[model samples]
Target: MDVFEHIQSAKGPSLFLLPEWQNRCHLLTAGFTGRSGGVSESPYTSLNMGLHVGDMDETVIKNRQLVSDALDWPFEAWTCAEQVHGNRVQRVTEEERGSGRETLANVIKGCDAIITNVPNVLLVSYYADCVPLYFYDPVHHAIALAHAGWKGTVQQIAQETILAMAEAYGSRPQELVAAIGPSIGICCYEVDGPVIGQVTLLLEKLGCSDDSADTMLELSDNGRANLNLKEINRQIMIKAGILPIHIELTQWCTGCRRDLFYSHRMEGGSTGRMASWIGIRER
Candidate 1:
């Protein structure tokens, strides 16, 4: 069964929810947004969660508010980072809550991963086709949102987030539940040149066998390879000590489902973004 359940409500933002996680902890909410039920115009055409995109700032903020309304989360708690496709993980605290909600100023800087144990602080990251990595430590009541493109994946952002959580919140990797959200799958993610070289080096560093590497990167005759970033990140999570069974990998490919998602590759680089969010409320 798919870990993220798609839900479209008549009066709210479209969302892909992590129902099992929500059910396991009534105070927790975790999910990704879809490209519908917002107020942005064409290209963005409704729900565009990214303020940095060409979408009007007001429209993007309204769309974000719609999501906050749907999630029943306070808009003041929507914290985000300016993702730089790097492995740096920022630890969000109570004072940093609500940064980057309405504007880019005061946003957490140059980090792909943001984690927080502070209750009611929602950590969000934007994506069109890049992978969204989620980490939750129920024992510590902490959660994280990481944006990983192929660059961040090669930098081992997953492992970096795990280590940051351990150092900041005393979260054990084995005890943490993680999720790899929707992104371009191998079916539609083809790459050549340095991307292929970097992925090959990463796989080797992960000690993946030839068969494992083959599964992650299928080389074509034209010097391009189809890359499965979700799988690669899953393996990285396992290597970083997260239990394989505890990690949920979604099969929804943004490239394949452009009707429901924004595909940067398929959409010719002019597209809006979806958001992946995770938070816990104080009881």
Candidate 2:
């Protein structure tokens, strides 16, 4: 069964929600946005949530505001970071709430992962084929969002986020719930020599056997390989102590389902980005 449930309402943002999480924790709202329901021109189409993607800042802000309204979350609480595809995790607090809600200038700097125990601070990160990693530690009342491209995945950003939550909020990795959101899957994410080399090194370090590594990276005769980023990140989560049963993996491949998502690789790089958001509301 698909973990990310698509809620297609005439009145709300086109969102793929983690319904299990919402049902488990009523105050929590966690999900990824689709490519509709807002105002933006061609290429960006409608509903582009990223401020850094060269879309009119005002237009992007309006789109974000629309989604916020749909989520019943205040646009003021929508906090974000400037993703650099690195492993750095920033711990968001009350003082830093709403850091990049309106503009990129105030966004948390140089981090791909943002974690917070602060209520009502909605953590968001943009995506256009890159994976969105969601983490929640109900025991600590904490949550996190990590932007994992192949670079961040190679750098083990998933592990970094886990460790950061453990250190900052005393979250036990075994007790944390995780979800791997929509992204370019192996069916469309083909990589060449340089990327293959980096992935090979990481797989070796993970002690993945040749057969298991082949499942993650299927090489072709032309020296390109289809990379399973979602699975790699899932394995990384397991390696970091998250139980297999606690992790949710989505089947929506952005590349395969461009009608429902934005694919930078498929659409030639000049495209808008969807958002992955997680927040714990204040009661």
Candidate 3:
């Protein structure tokens, strides 16, 4: 039942209770991957959507086209950043589609998150270790997508994007339904002392509490702390005043499901990326 909606012969990573996504005919979003689909050989394997990952351009293009077709979107309406991993959040419009090509040429000036009230403009971001966050305020019919690595998370990109939507589109935080996409979870995210300290400090500044959340933490073999990024972002969303019930964290971990996802740490630099995208449709 979790088969790829695009090809009769395709399958995706083991899905985990994405029924909210599957049931909503108008719900514009999806994510999670492993080694099953795509046309790239060996390293890239089957469903690699990244154009810059040394996969054949046409192959990547085809995978993209397949995704677009699966979602009933035009292939050309997709947007992505060069991903500088900064705190900048770009407000995507009708004009920014296809701006990422190379490390520069079609890339957005500098940004880590993207938002739009525009319909059918799917936003894509690559990830192997960082977290993917999605925002949708159906009341305003708008959506925002973000990538938060350690640096961007400390800068509170999720909170920033929510505020941006509030300012530009009058989207209320309570009306926003957020989804924490599949990412490196506590089981595989081992980090050193400084990052732990920084994350802790930021969590405090954001007013997150262990009391309100039933989250778990672990220490890796190297003594680095393993974190549940989905939970971390969920707490940030709560602090931003978003309704708790409206948030969904995909109960899947990329590193654990390496057969279904593209992990940078797992596949080295030669692997491709699985893209997470969300968008509104023109009413």
Candidate 4:
């Protein structure tokens, strides 16, 4: 089943909520944003959640505030990280609540993954075409968000987030529930030789046979291959011990759904960003 439920509303940000997780944990709210229902101009158009992408800072804040209001979360709880396409994971605390919500100046620096057991601190990461990785450990009440572009995927950001959660909150991978949110899919994501080379190395490390690897990275006649990033991240999550049954994978591809999402590659790099967020409300 498609777990990212799209909520069509007349006001505020249009969002995709993870209903299963919310049903399991009443206080938890998690989802991704769409491109409609915001104040930004073209390129950013509307509902742009990224602050560093040349959008008016205040306009970006307004868009973010809309998301917070729609979630009924205080804008003060919106925390973020400056994704550097690396495997570094930052363990957020109460003090880090609301960091980088409005500007890149205070964003969690050089981190692609952010994990926290701290309540009332909403963890957010921006994305455009790249995969948005979600992790939750009900056993420890810990939730995390990771940004996985090809570089981060090759570096195993998913595993890094899992290991960080285990070290910080004693979250066992077996007890963790994960989700791969909207991103580019194999049909719309073609890659060149350099990317194929790195992905080849990672596939070998994952012990994928040529046939299986072909499904994840299929070679084409044009000296390029289509890469299924979402699937690769799902495999990484499983390799890290997250149960297959506990993971939810979304079929919405950013590159394919340009009307509903902002695709950097599809839009030729002049695009806004959607946000993937997860947080436990303050009790």
Q: Distance (Å) between predicted and true CA of 118, model 4?
A: 0.6
lDDT by residue for model 2 (51-141), tens? 8888999999999999999999999999999999999999999999989989888999999999999999999999999999999999999
TM-score of each: 0.99, 0.99, 0.86, 0.98
lDDT of 1 at 245: 94
Put the candidates in lDDT order, highest first. 2, 1, 4, 3
Candidate ranking under TM-score, highest first, comes to 1, 2, 4, 3
**Residue 194 error for model 2, in Å?**
0.8
**Per-residue error (Å), model 1, residue 251:** 0.7
Tens digit of lDDT per residue, candidate 3, span 65-182?
6666666777777788877777777888888876663334686767889888887777877777688888887787888889988788888889999999999899999888888877
lDDT of 1 by residue, 160-243 (tens): 999999999999999999999999999999999899999999999999999999999999999999999999999999999999
**Model 2 off-target regions past 4 Å?**
none
Model 2: colliding residue pairs: none
Off by over 4 Å in 4: none
